[model samples]
Target: MRSRSAPPTVRDVAARAGVSPGTVSKALNGTGQLRAATRDRVAAAAEELGFRPNHLAKSLLEGRTYTVGILTSDSFGRFTTPVMVGIEDALGAGRMSTLLCDGRGDPLRERHYVQELLNRRVDGLVVTGRRPDPRPSLGRLPIPVVYVLVQSDDPEDLSLTYDDVQGAALATEHLVASGRKRFAHVSGPERHWSTQRRREGVGRALEAADLPLAPELVLLGQWSEAWGRTAAAQLLRRDSGVDAVVCGSDQIARGVADGLREAGADVPGRVAVVGFDNWDVMVEAARPPLTTVDPNLTALGQHAATRLMDAIDGKELPRGVHRQPCDLVVRQSSV
Candidate 1:
């Protein structure tokens, strides 16, 4: 029988390439200073020898776990899933793994999870929440911390949040340009930053069009479809002259459209409707494809990861809220 061959080691590759083990390590781990020619040689030798570094041993030497921590207010939320996918894809491309923790919207639990991540010596941290608030304690952590889909408490902290103001402006402008003068708004939770920004954008757009926002036409409620239905019914009952309805979210828009249809109103023909948060699959599958704002949640996650990675590499990122742009996806709902 043939003798079993021993697994290749970093030492074998370094020797074969005529370079020190340290140089080979630096080239493989994407760290340290090594000449291009030497790095290439080591890489070629490693491939030939089938050398794979022991990750545990490497972590021990570098004092880095090569793991990132992600904390979300609600892991099962529709918006959180796609954003997490984007974050994971970006981090995986960098050869990093993630440890996810769900806070369930509890501040105490969030604080506890942060401490646990720190204790594990995570390479970086990502925090996701609906509300934007200053995070003074995060700055004290030794590793980099990034806020995603939320604003940080401190103005100087790094964050990646959706451009709700721009999204709402685009939606409202589209309606105004299309000759819809009498506009109404169906909003989400009053306390949400996204809700406030979106409402502000709509208000600004209406003001620019020289049309005052009719207070009776504005309806504020939760982010649920039920709330949208109720609000839409109430608005229609109270204001029969409204030509359009701007929704804070796609889910709310869906409800509004349903309510209108039930009331014998033809969407886009009688009353045009627009909403934020693209929600492609869900919104696209609707009978009348919904016109909504694509918040680019995936891009938001990827940008946050990139920023955190740069900070880890000793790069200086400009501090403050980093707003990612939103695109309006036109569909049948808005015509």
Candidate 2:
């Protein structure tokens, strides 16, 4: 066994494998031509001796830092948390560490974070946002960058975001499959791109089924539980015959659920409900589990990390928006 004072080195591995130190280096890095048997022997000897390479030394020698910086508008927000998890998971597998900075949606804070990351010499950068709206570009930088759940106004940058329209369509189709005929939509403000896309999705789904999304039945309000309650009350008063309501968010769906019970309607029996953003807390804690559309935020983060890595490795990446697909999660509220 090797001494406990220190870890085994390349020389010890070469001696154990009966090869020259230079030959061992070649085999380990796959740089020089070597016989297959010699390479295998060197690998086995290194494994038996528990030899670990100094990645920091190797990174310095190669003139690259194996670190990335991630700038997020709201790190504590539910939507951003899962995406950050995904980015970390992917980067760790590639032997890369990350520096996270929260800008809290302030331009000055964002600029400061960017300068700090650049000073640290990060190999790459990833910018994440809670919403999927377009923002001012970060401008040119020494390192490659990729945007997550948000788009850069600069056409030269790359971005990865969810297909909100597809997600909403999935939720609407599920509700339709549950034998719902009369339907209504309660969503966030019309100014948000997500809200606009999801509202369009609802209309498209109904159109495909030979139905119509009556303007009077659609309520545009805040992305909050309070709005959900208010909209549900007004919707029920206007049309108590509504069989299902598609909400913009899970929080809203929870309020709608409470409003339905208060209005003397049986959930899933008389009025089905569906929501967007499958946030587990809100979905599982509802009176009856809520059915919702998942934006696949984790997958979006993973894709963004992968793209940045590719760019770092001298691969030419296409600039523009990349859309990731979303799916539906069924629960008691919508069959």
Candidate 3:
């Protein structure tokens, strides 16, 4: 019997299983056609001996590293954490390893990390960022690249991101269906793509109900609770008759709720409120739990990983920006 400390080699496994070294290789690596009985015997032998294949040699033979790289611009990891969990879960099942690099929104750092990942011979890469805007493409590279959350400017590149327009529309429709009319919108910086898309969504939905968003009712400001609170006072001053308010982010929604409550207005009674980004911290901690839109970022990450795997397997990458749908989470605030 071999010593327990030393691992069993393919030769030893072959000897025990009554097969040649080449046949053992074929069985373990899944390289050639073999009888069911023979494969079973080899597998059984391997299990008993705790024989693990040498991945280094196997990579050389197959010309594949079985490794993937994940590059993210979200240094704080607020958005990247959930996405990474999904990517790891999907890639781990395929016995692929992952390497992560943070660009922290720096061009020089991003370029450096990209070069380093390429030097490591990764089979594919997944690119992610917190921004919802479309960025300039990374340009053609040696391996397949999948973009998550942030879209690539190139329509041909496979970019998976949440559908901001649809999510906003969903929120507005819910409020409209609740019999609340005379709507007002509060959002982040005017230049943000998410802000534009969400505003368009609310406008379209309201227009469908024959209540188009007017110029004075649309409030564009920084994404902050203070701004939301200030906007609330502004809305009351501008249009006290407005019954429903849709905001671009949960933080802003929470602030609006506070402002309305502080102004002696009953929430959901005098003014119903809705928010985007179903962030638990902001939504749950609010005076009344917020009704918000969930971007479903984890699912987006999983899809990106699967696409990278497919591309590595010699399949052509599907062209275009794929918009993943967001889900609406209802709470006391909207009711």
TM-scores, one per candidate? 0.88, 0.91, 0.91
- Model 2, span 121-158: residue lDDT tens: 89999999889988889999988999999889988998
Q: Write the per-residue lDDT of candidate 3 for residues 27-52, one digit (tens) a residue.
A: 98777989989999999999998999
Q: What is the lDDT of residue 131 in candidate 3?
A: 76
Off by over 4 Å in 1: 1-6, 14-23, 30-50, 131-139
Q: What TM-score does model 2 achieve against the real structure? A: 0.91
lDDT by residue for model 1 (1-335), tens: 32348788887888899988888888998788888888889999999988888989978987789899999886566777778888888898888899999988787888899999989999999988654433433555778888888777776677778778888999999999888988999988887777888999999999998987888888889987888889878978998877799999888998898888888778988889997888876588754788999888888888888888888778976677888878989999877
lDDT of 2 at 122: 91
lDDT, candidate 3, at 205:
92
List residue ranges in candidate 2 displaced over 4 A. Answer: 1-4, 20-50
The better-scoring model by lDDT among 2 and 3 is 3
RMSD of each: 3.0, 2.5, 2.4
Sort by lDDT, best first: what order?
3, 2, 1
Q: Candidates 1 and 3: which is better by lDDT?
A: 3
Worst 10 residues of 3 by lDDT: 206-215
Best by lDDT: 3
